[model samples]
Target chain A: MATPQLKQTPLNAAHRRMGARMVDFGGWDMPVQYPYGTIEEHLRTRTHAGLFDVSHMGEIDVRGRDAIAFVNRVTSNDASKLVDGQAQYSALTTPEGTVVDDLLVYRFAEDHLLLVVNASTTPKDWEWIRSHKQDEAVELKNMSAEYCQLALQGPDALRILQTLTDLPLSEIKYYHFREGAVDGVPSIVSRTGYTGEDGFEVYAAAERAEQLWDRILEAGRFGETDGVMPCGLAARNTLRLESAMALYGNDIDETTTLLEANLGWICKLGKGVFIGREALARQKEEGVKRRLVGFEVTERGIARDHQDVLVNGERVGQVTSGSPAPYLKKNIGLAYVPVEFAGAGQEIQIDVRGRAVGAQIVPTPFYKREKKQSAGSHQPSAKTQ
Target chain B: MANVPEDLHYSKDHEWLRVEGDVAVIGITDYAQNSLGDVVYVELPKPGEKFEAHESFGSVESVKAVSEIFTPVSGEVVEVNESLSDEPEKVNEDPYGAGWMIRMRMNNPGEVDSLLSSVEYEEFTSAETE
Candidate 1:
């Protein structure tokens, strides 16, 4: 018998009210799609705006005199270079250079930082962080259960959020954040998101989240066009896939290294030591044997996880994440392949359900955003920015 | 939910079987297609391949995941669906008629009695959540 799935987010009732199809996602009962369908929700986020209940993600607060130093030693990215109000994408890795989880580290101040980890790995990450914090004076607090995260993503995100806050939305630069109020609810509005589009991630008290969700939906109605709709996990996956954003378990796991996963950019060996710096530096200098490459199926067949990857009739690697990109209307996936076959335009084959289908290596970011205003275009007032 | 034709018999694994003299036609039930979502590919047993009861005969892949198709009874594969290679969605569109996966010469015709009738299959699937 199938075990009952775990808890729901604060917006679970609201999702049902909006006609969402709920599914068990990593043990959390979450919305997979709304009545508008995955394709419609995806296009809305790409062309206009979409709201997402991302409360399932894990959040932790690190604070102390040694917080910055503590974080710099634990994560792969060069965290010491981060300025107040800025955030950087980084990875927490095992001693062997394998990625434990990919996360965002937000520098709230010189002495305080916020780490957002994948939901499934929250418990394990918390334990790992806590164990490593032994000598440091830093206070590690798992604030995941206390806050609800909502992502307002796409082109019109700033416009929709502008109506709710007197703080200038345009002043908040990409990957930067500010404290703001949404319908009387205090929130941390950060110009960051997973969708490779301009957006804001709002962190608010869990109890106040439902009201804020309703207010955002109401605010959308006043726009010149129908504004943002609540999107679920299905469109979220497709949107991230099109952007070539890596999903935690599928694209990179504890068994996969950052270098092999094409995330060497996040590893900064020139800086002081980190958890997996030694292993990562060795892999970087020696060159990765197998590398993750993006591929588009030229023929029919949707390559999926664990499917064998063949190059010149020889099995080399396997697909890690695959899907029929709704936006591109073609089958696309990411796989680990021999470095020789990782270049763009190289021919390859994916064994889909035992049949080899033609595919081609492609550049990352299968979809790109049209040129828009610069990230610097958004800045808050001198007092609040 | 799609209707299960009264003449067909279904196994607990969701395969539907139809007896035509000594030969048996095997395909996935309508409930299986609905649950699997858009069928993108189907792998069928090769002609003349023999299998024991409960052995995996082939597999079907959808956008969401893959599931193995099992043989309900021991048999020798007589033929496989050729059109599915070009039009796999037919399994979702018409699972009973055009989506038939294979035909086999049943080694034990007596095993047919163990398959559920359309009425029993409907009841079995009605309690299942999609």
Candidate 2:
């Protein structure tokens, strides 16, 4: 069979001009790295700033009178608790309490919400959301193709962005957002990202994305800014892995439950009924069958996806995502194991390419958190006096 | 793309064999390494294992995918690269040198004639690219 053709992002030309090695990422033709490679990009993002073009991810806008109420019934998180300019990480689950997609719920206002979903699961999520839209007052519009998104991540992300807008970025607390102009292009800058770093995600008109990308790259050339580079899917994956952030298809899928996936925090039992709430409540009461846990290989060999998890030579569960961590310099993976062996520090073995490698369960977020500047110190004029 | 070394014989599967007396040093060609970016792990055949020509020996895994390694010539595996277990990225860095996968005693020295020459392997990979 012929290799699949890749889908182009808005910044394809820019990536090519920068001499990036492009690859097929979930159908999107994205740069896996510049000439410097994934290791450099990974380190750059952790230490300084890195720019990423994540325009391929789908964005849907939920608006109208019953928008908040409608969304509250579809997702695991209590959407009603989100104030304007606040964003909450959530999951959309099936009636059986299995995940449909993990998403970001950005409450722009009381009646307007922006849902950012996984690229591969976009169509299915849209269909599911629309199918459940029974209220005439709710309007669901897919604006994924209309906007382009960029992530500026690292410790210096705030400094680099502050140079462009007079808006006080320090005041935009983590998981909060504001609408403003970047180089005259109206954009929404959100203080949230998947890399577990201090960063901001900028959403702007697709036509203006190239201009914005170039501007940020140019600004990143300043002093103490050698760390800024264009990151591709390779570095993004490793960064997210080190942060213990779950990938949708690998870590949580349509059959994976919020409880089993270790995302119980997103499922609220006290709130009014939502889809999958009863099943999740029952799981909570009776205890879950399997749990997703992080593990580090104690022996040589890299554990990979779909490998079997063995406890005392008995096949118990399976590995979902595994890699030799670039930062930790050890083979680490996420696996679904029996609830008994899921606790941190539990010993286990992962069958890697037919050989069992010794491993021990560890705490989540394998990477350490970097200190961030307080939002009150840099509040934007529109949000403050 | 780097030129395939003229001193080595190539397999259609992209393995390179450098015959030194009765022993052959085996490694993947530059074309293979470039195609399989950033190799993270290499599973080598056990030392003393015997295999026929074109037989599966082990596998090379990258972050994106995994591919089987094929024996270029029927031989008894005499040694495997132990250094690769700790650092597989060497295959991406210097595929022909320290990244060499195995050393084997060739079953028949005349089998080298059936393998491609460096120039032939270059033309073969170039054609495949187009």
Candidate 3:
């Protein structure tokens, strides 16, 4: 089959100038790593700050009097509970309780909210939302191409980003956002991250992406090594994996439900009549049969995605996402198994090709950010549901 | 730019062969290591295993991707680099020496002549990067 032309972010030229290895990520030409490599970028993001071009992520604007009602009906979370400037991780679920796409709902006003969906799922999500619109006053616009999202993550994220934006970043609690001028560019500054690190995600107009990117890079480029690393998709994956956050295609998809993927915290079944609520409520009452669990490879091999998960040499399930956790310094992964074998200490095997490798079930969020006393208390930011 | 050692025989697949009598010292080339980034894990065939020329005998996995290590010539594996199991990054640090994957008794040493030389391998890799 012939390949289609890959989409490019506004910062494509900048990435090329930095000598980053570009790859096709969900049909978009994205940087997978720079000359420093994924491991170094991953480590630096944990210790220092890391800049990421996240412009390919889809954005949708939900507006009108029925916006809150419309969002609540389609998403698994209770949007009514969210106040202006707050955000929550939620999912669009099918009637069968399976995920359509996990997204972030940022409430800007009583009748306006911004929905950030995965890059690959933009068109589908738009179609799904438009088709599901019942004679409601809510108007949904796919503004994915109009915005450029950049994440400045890690321990020094605030210190770095604060230089460019006059917004009191530390005052912005986790998962909450504020609209402000960042380096003269209007942007939505949100305290959220996928790396399990306390960080900020800034969204600005797509055309001004290069300017925003350059400003952030210049603001944080301290000395020879004290600066933020310009990270890429490869490091992003490893960082999220170490945090045990679910990747849409790998950990959660149409075949999986919120409960099975361990995202039940975001599934508000009692919020009244949302799609998939009935099925999820039933599952809750009946109890989930299979669940996603984190495991560490006890043996020599690294268990990769799509590898089979076994119990006593019998195939039970497959690894959803697996790799060497750079921060944890061990090979870890998430896999589904029968509820009886889901608890920590349960021995399981991962079929790395034909080899049965020893592994033990462990509690997830494989890595967590340390709470620094000087910064006071900040909410532990949640990832995509 | 990759460091190409002229003393080694290079395979198009990027394996470097150093012939020591009948036993061939084989590992991936400097070009391969530079492209692979950090080596996180190295999976190798046990000693005494036999492999055909151009057949993948093992794999080297980095943080980004996985690459198979193919043999330039058919051989019986006499010794495997067990140290790589613990220190796979040695491949990135020193591809020619400590990262040597295996010592093999080749069925035919003449197959080494069929592989690329230092100049040809460097030319081919430069074209690949372009």
User: Per-candidate DockQ versus the true complex?
Assistant: 0.23, 0.45, 0.82
What is the lDDT of every predicted structure here? 0.85, 0.86, 0.90
Would you list the rank order by DockQ, best first?
Answer: 3, 2, 1
Candidate 1 local lDDT, A1-385, one digit each (tens): 9788687889889998887868988878899887666766788899889899999999989999999889988899888988898888888988889988999999988899999999889999999999887588799999999999999999989998888888788888888898879777999999988777899999999999898898887787623356787888878987888888888999888999988887877888888878999999898889888888888999867888889999888999999888877768778988888888888999999998678999999887888787587884321100100
Clashing pairs in 2: A170-A375, A171-A375, A171-A378
Off-target runs (Cα >4 Å) in candidate 1 are: A1-5, A16-21, A221-227, A376-385, B1-34, B38-62, B67-119
What would the per-residue lDDT of candidate 1 be over residues B24-114, giving only the tens digit for each residue? 9999998898767667778787899999877899888765568899987789999999999878889988999999999999999988999
- Comparing chain B with the reference, what is the TM-score for each candidate? 0.96, 0.98, 0.98
Q: Across residues B1-130, which tens digit of lDDT does each residue of candidate 3 receive?
A: 7898989999989999999999999999888988888899999999899999999999999976779999999989999999999999999999999999999999999888899999999999999987
Residue-level error in angstroms, candidate 2, position B103: 2.1
Provide the TM-score, chain A, model 3. 0.97
Per-residue C-alpha lDDT of model 2 across residues A144-194, encoded as one tens digit per residue: 989999999998898888878877788888889999988788999999887
Task: Name the 10 consecutive residues with the lowest summed lDDT in model 2 chain A.
Answer: A376-385
Computed on C-alpha atoms, the DockQ of candidate 3 is 0.82
- Chain A, model 1: TM: 0.95
lDDT ranking from best candidate downward? 3, 2, 1
* lDDT score for residue B74 of model 3: 95
